[model samples]
Target: MKNINKNRLFIASCLALITTAMTFAIRARLETVFGPEGIGLTLEQIGYAFAPAFFGFTIAMIIGGPLVDLLGIKKITWMAFLTHAVGIVLTLLADSMTSLFIATLFIGIGNGFVEAALNPMVASMYPEQKTKMLNRFHVWFPGGIVIGAILGWLIMDVLGLSWQVMVGALFIPLVIYGVLFFGQKIPVTERVQLGISNQKMFSSVLKPLFLFMVACMFLTAASELGTTQRIESLLKESVAKPLLVLAFINGIMALGRLFAGQVVHKLSPSGMLLYSAIFTFIGLWLLTVTSGGMTFVAAAVFAVGVTFFWPTMLGFVAEYLPETGALGLSIMGGAGMFSVSIVLPVMGNLMDNASAAEALRTMSILPAILIVAFFGLHMYMKKRQKTFEV
Candidate 1:
């Protein structure tokens, strides 16, 4: 194999990071626009609007995963760029709930393709460092949230700029990433490169165990992001500035993901996941029961809990279900976002009728359910290995 271009790979990784951050930034702002007092949309309405991103992501992943193998990365990369551009343009024109929803759907689809194209691309480029590199690569998800949150504060809150200006900020990175991918030699999908048959990959992805994991991933993602994205509205009664709180939580998450290699090296993904759930439980409980800066602390703890959840889940699938290939990873990503899409509206409904505390308390059930699910997954994997050996 020819030597992998570290510089190009690094550039690609950065673009992926920026795209993730941009998506979340827009997500964060959506609550602001569609929240109770902003444009007079209810919590449920905001949640429904946000649903498009996850559903679009799921659509892209299920559709694009195989295409990445057949059509190659260059075509997928261009698709991501075009979809993102069109989505953002639609979002900027949004005036009502209907327009906002449509725009978000397009943007969500674009965001999903970004992951569908880039994740396996990165995994293939740095084959030897699958876990670490992927974790490091995923640093941008939380990292971008932090950037988005801070930008939210700077443009919308502190500088008193129009929210439209903040939405427009995404165009900068979209153009840059597009430029970076231009003329770049895209790497082969990991499954193809490993010489795995498409049938094997399909079977591995659709296996009962894998499907069960996908179910758990969806709930975990919904529980994690659905709650965090609403931190501003949920804590509006407590925090003087909700966006600042969002920034603080994401700051810790970004730092944690950047250092995830050290954490993963010390603990198995299952162990890390269990630990994450515990922290998430404690954090959510505290957020629900407390007030003031303590709420921020709770948010930080919750961030730490989920810090490893997204990338680690991918790493787990990659390590344990390698035959599932890019399709599996795509499904994992899609399922996660899809789960969030479903949960966002539920959270919105809860907040609409019940108190913010009630909504959070309701969301807490997700992690509790996952605690049991992870243990089951661990046992299943162990039993599978035993069966394989016999």
Candidate 2:
């Protein structure tokens, strides 16, 4: 702690996450910009174009996770900055399906590297408060979405400016975080500090509990991110300002994450996931039925549901599977983003062939499975807690 700047490191992590969240918001706007009304790509094609972001994220995390242990966190972080810069420039010049798809791939990998570098860094920085600190660090995801969504709304919808203007906005953060992390010292990952071998780390993640969470990570990420990524297409038929609804949903989410410690303390991480799944399922059901201002209400419910899903999932692993270390955290994150990659195209196809409501109904099914799975997880944890206490 003496040689390190924890405050600066934490700030850089949040800013990096903010950059990642802004990409999501900007890309959501891009779907409509490049849709039938604008550049004429079909929603399904746009989904295919955007698919790289999630899967690319999965790829980066899978590779970067182990690399973070072998190399230091600082190298992966700078890799994020370079890729983010390239992605932004590419996005600005992009005019075709191939160009947009490639642009998103760089951004996706940059996003993945950001998560890869930061999650373990935070865990190492505050081992005592992994859940609370991780939640606090992740608050910027939705917070950045609100910033990016509103800015997109004002810049495009209100100012009537070009979409490239919004894409260009990412460079601002890309540079700032790069500067902050340039010379600062980063701690060794918790795994390295504990002297656990790579073989042991890899085997720990193969545990039945870790594998169970991996399966659930697929559903949770799809149920949360898959739905939001397509919010514009899903709700455009009903709401005049679907972006605002996106903003509203994330605004509530930002607030929920800002105060997640209290909720996590009371409910425990498994209980929190259970609660989120139920609310998300119910909220997605409401979005399929409700219209107009009521959409915000349904969205508010949805926001509250997904508020803790991502961070809590990471926290649960850090707390329970301490030996899995950076690699474990990366697998959880990689699994989540990978699931979103698979679902985005499916949701888009549903939007194209069927209806938004039908797609939403299909999404709600994921959390329904989660509700059952998490209930089992909660009970399993409860029994384990009692055994430990005795």
Candidate 3:
């Protein structure tokens, strides 16, 4: 404990998350830049181009998760830095759909590495406050999106700067986090420190409850990311400044996550997931019918719903299923991203053949599924707690 710099490590982790979140904002803006109106690529093509971001994340998390133990978190973290640097430069140079796809792939891998490394890192560092601290740590995800969205608006929309400038903004956080992590003493993961063998970790992930959560991860991630990733296209005709709306939604999310401790205490992780699904379903359906100023209200509800979804899901695994270790967290994260990767193209096709409103309604179905799943989870957990009590 004397050697561990919890404050510095937590700050560095937040910086890494901010870097990851900026990519989402930049990619959202890029949708318009490379869309049929701009570069003449169809929405489906843009979806394909963006596919790498999620799947690449899946690959990195799956690969890096196991490696975090063998290679060490420090090594995996630096790996993320290297990949993010390469991805940013490639994105700046990308013009065609093929080039964009490759660049996004690299960024997605980098983003995956960030989560693969940092989520476990934070969980390890704060064992007593896993859910609360992880939620605080995740504030940067939406917080960074808010920064990136505003920067994109100011640089491209208000100031008329090149999109390249917006891409360049990623370098600032990238450099800061690198400096913070350098020469710092990194800790072994909680699993390794507790002497949990690799076999135990792997087997834990195969358990019925763990597998169930992974299944739900797919739907939860798609409901949140699939919708937000295509916010520009979905809200194009319905809103004035979609990016601002994106910013507004993430802004609320950032604030909500910052104070997640109170909520997690009251609702429990399973309860939170159940409630999030409820709000998300309502929000998505509302967006289908709303326009103009009312769009922000609907987005607000959606943001509140998804605010706890990602980090809370990870936190639940880290807390209740601690035996699954880094690999478990990685598999959960990888599953979510992989699902988004699949849904992105389908959503793009929906946009092409149907309306954006129709796409929103379709995305709503994901959370609708989660509602039933999480309700089952809540009941299962309650019954298990009762068994333990007896």
lDDT of each: 0.81, 0.93, 0.94
Off by over 4 Å in 1: 1-4, 379-390
Task: Report the C-alpha lDDT of model 2 over 267-320, residue by residue, as the tens digit.
Answer: 989999999999999999999999998999999999999999999999999999
Score every model by TM-score.
Answer: 0.95, 0.99, 0.99
Backbone clashes counted, model 3? 0
192: Cα error in model 2, Å: 0.6
Writing each residue's lDDT as its tens digit, candidate 3 over 1-390 gives 569798998999999999999999989998999998888899999999999999999999999999999999999999999999999999999999999999999999999999999899999988999999999999999999999999999999999999999999999999999999999999889999899998898889999989999999999999999998999999999998899999999999999999999998898899999999999999999999999999999999999999999989999999899999999999999999999999999999999999898888889888989999999999988998899999
Root-mean-square deviation (CA) per prediction: 1.9, 0.7, 0.7
State residue 265's C-alpha deviation in candidate 2, in Å. 1.6
Compute the lDDT of residue 247 as modeled in candidate 2.
89
lDDT score, candidate 2:
0.93
Residue 13 local lDDT, model 2:
95
Query: Which scores higher on lDDT, 1 or 3?
Result: 3
lDDT of 1 at 83: 87
